[model samples]
Target: MKKLAFIGLGNMGMPMARNLVQAGYYVYGLNRSKGKEKTFQELGGQAAESLSYIAENADVIMTCLPQPADVEQMLTGEEGLLQMNIKAPLIIDFSTVSPSLHTAIETKATEKGARYLDAPISGGTAGAEAGTLAIMCGGKKEVFEEAKPLFDVLGANITHAGPAGSGTKVKLINQYMVGMHTAAVGEALHLADQSGIDQSLVYSVLSNSFAQSKIFDRHYNDFISEDKDEPGFALELLLKDLGLAGEMAKESNASLKAGDLVRDLFENADTNGYGKKDMSVLYQYVKQQED
Candidate 1:
């Protein structure tokens, strides 16, 4: 079996890496923060001391960072993966980033004799913990086939979207709807509150009607119902994805009229200090807005 190095042990990455370890793979878990490595070690995974250690030893390197800049830095920075003399590792990224960035990384990987798959994931932290993420991969079919077994351990719905940047393209479209639907849920619930209708009744009815969505189910049941607002998927992260989606539309010379308004909603919520909270907290922000 090939040894794997899993980097960025955050909300999504930690559980995904843990699933890999539980599946009997030899995984070296690395994180920028201090204590996560120790936690991963306790879960029967090795803790990587440095990127150099991973570059020298890992046959497959996987990263699940938060931003495109972080992904680029981890690959191209001083003492980063591409800077080291690696043995042509299979690199997989499970972060939501721009397709253009994925294309650029693929180019760099090809130049370095490394294999790359842009395999951005959906299904949030709950799905990550349950090992049921939907992984959309973009790369050579042969490379994707080689990595499919590893992906199987991390996701239930896995697809090879196409080559180079295709996976991110699909993911961006998914996020586009996610952002819009999230905002709509906020508006619907706020309307219910203002009109003296029961929010729970509204959700129950919509959940059975055409107004239903996975986002509505999750946001209401997990966060909004209890008023918790923990970061299952952070508002700022969704804002970032919405921005990426808008950029993608612009690049394709397509118009996303409603996308602008939704982006502004998220941006306003972020600016009002709801960025780090659960994306469902957009409800609170929406409720505060006046006509």
Candidate 2:
């Protein structure tokens, strides 16, 4: 059995870890929240209080943290994974973080005989639940192939994009499109109301048009199916990803007028306390404009 240590047992991480355990890996999960750990244990995963224990014992260490700061704390903080005598060569990061930070961690991990991969994911909570995420990875070709089965268990479309940090670069492009489409959805809904068209009719018509997109489908899928709204991917996280897109554009000496414009729009909403809402509430941003 290949022992695995999975960190971050949040909405997305929990199911991902469960899949690995279901696939017959000896899975150990690390979570700061005791409740999360308890749930993981309930799902047949072992819980460890320390990253050291996970790093020391597991054959692979996978992280699904929220931010670059969290990733840094787990890798270099007290009782960090790097503090262990790592017999495992694979350390896969599933967070959407700065490419530079990913590069820095990869450099440091390589020095300690550990291979690192920046492998941010898409597919939202539904994808996590259905095990059909699109994973974009940046790492050496050999390491990526070696880890293919593990990613295959978690995602449907796994692309080994290129060398270190490139996965995150691809992630930024992905977010930029999402932001634009979300903003468009907001505007289209607002316009439909203004023109007195039935909301469902407009959506149905657009759903068949050339402008139709996965993002459009994403807006209606889960929340539409449930008739109630919950945060699968929160607005704050999308706002953060948009900000990263702005930064990425600047670093590449590329102009991101549209991305920056969308970031500013999301920032405005977040500033007004809508940060924790579903990103589809971009409709509210349009509402604010009408008011």
Candidate 3:
């Protein structure tokens, strides 16, 4: 088994690293924030002090950062993995960054005699915790095959999405639908509230109807109905992915009419200070507009 370095112990990363530990990998966990290190330690994982530690120690380094810049730093910064003379042969990035950045990082990894995969994921925190995420990977077929055992520990649906940037390309498509669906769910629920339909009844009927989705089930039952705004996936993160989608669309000369509108809706919610809240809070933003 390749010794693993799991970087970024946030909402998604922590659970993912824990799952790897549970599967009996000698996984070293690292994070920018020191607080999360103890949580990983409790789960039978080793916590590294810094990226340099992982670079010098592990054979496979995986990152689940939040932004493109962070991913860039991991690959290109002064103390980045590429700069280290470590023998880690594989790097997997699960961050939902741009295809161009994925390609750039893959090239850099190649120069350092390492294989890189842009393997953005889905299924949210629940999926991460459950070890059933959907991982779409872009890299060499042989490298993906080598990584399959590790990916199997984290995801239910593991697909090789062609060349270096295809995983992020597929992920942007997923996020595009996710944005529109969340917006649709918000608007539909707001309309139901306005029409004096019992919110419970609306959810109950939709749960059995063709209009139902994972968004409705999660938003209505878990967070919105309970009036909880604790972030599962934050509104700002969705906004960031949508912004990336907009950039991808422009680059491909594709028109994103619905995507643009949904982006603006999330932007409005973020601007109004709901950015840190769960994306289900988009319902509250939609409802407040009519007040």
Candidate 4:
């Protein structure tokens, strides 16, 4: 059994680290915030004292941070992992960052005698808690094979996307669709409200029709119906992902005709105080828009 250290015990990371502990792994958890480490320790995970402690002791180091900069800091900051004299540890990243940054980090890891994998994940907080996330990995195939068992413990669907950065590329495309579909769901539901059709009726009918999507089900069933906007996935986070997708598209010279419009809608909504709310709050934002 490989000793593992998990950093960033936020919404997705805490549950993920907890799942590893439940599976009988001697997992060490570190968080920038204060209370989460205490919470993780209560769940049978060791609370790592510092990045140095993790670097010196952990056989495998995993990160599930929110942004590319956070990931980079964990590996490249003055007190970062790469600065420490770590053995040849396998590093797996579960953040949804850019392929360019992912590749850059892989190069840095290589210089430090560390193996790297870009293994961004999906399925939201529910999937993270349920241990059913879909993980897309990019790295050497042999390195991927060595990490498969750990991935198995964390996710239900895992795929080796290709070489370094390929996983983030695939994940960015997935986020592109996720943003588009989420915006469409808001628009459709708002249209239903404008037509004076009961929102539940619209959901019930469309859910079984060709118009249905997993995003629709998630937004309506989990958040909108209950009038709850707690952040299963934050609106701001989706906006960030949409921006990253747009950047990737520009780099690839791919034209996404509706991408800019959808991104603008989310941006306006986030600006209007929906940033901390569940992404499904886009429906409320759409409904409140001036006709």
Which prediction has the highest lDDT against the true structure? Answer: 1
lDDT of 1 by residue, 100-215 (tens): 88888888888889999999999999899999999999999999999999999999999999998999999999999999999999999999999999999999999999999999
The parts of candidate 3 lying over 4 Å away from their true place are: none
Give TM-scores for every candidate, taking all chains together and pairing residue i with residue i.
0.98, 0.96, 0.98, 0.98
Residue 176 local lDDT, model 1: 96
| Model 1, runs deviating above 4 Å | none
Candidates in order have lDDT scores of 0.94, 0.85, 0.91, 0.92
**Positional deviation of 23 in candidate 1, in angstroms?**
0.4
Q: Write the per-residue lDDT of candidate 4 for residues 116-188, one digit (tens) a residue.
A: 9999999999999999999999999999999999999899999999999899899989998999999999988
Mark the regions of model 2 whose C-alpha exceeds 4 Å error after superposition: 224-227
Candidate 1, position 80, lDDT: 69
Per-residue lDDT tens digits for candidate 3, residues 1-291, read: 678999999999999999999999999988888778888999999979677777877899999999899998888788788998868578999999999998888888898889999999999999999999999999999999989999999999999999988999999999999999899988998998889898899888988999999988888888988999999999999899999999999999999998888899999999999999999899999989888
* TM-score of predicted structure 3: 0.98
Q: After superposition, how far is residue 49 of candidate 4 from its true place, in Å?
A: 1.0
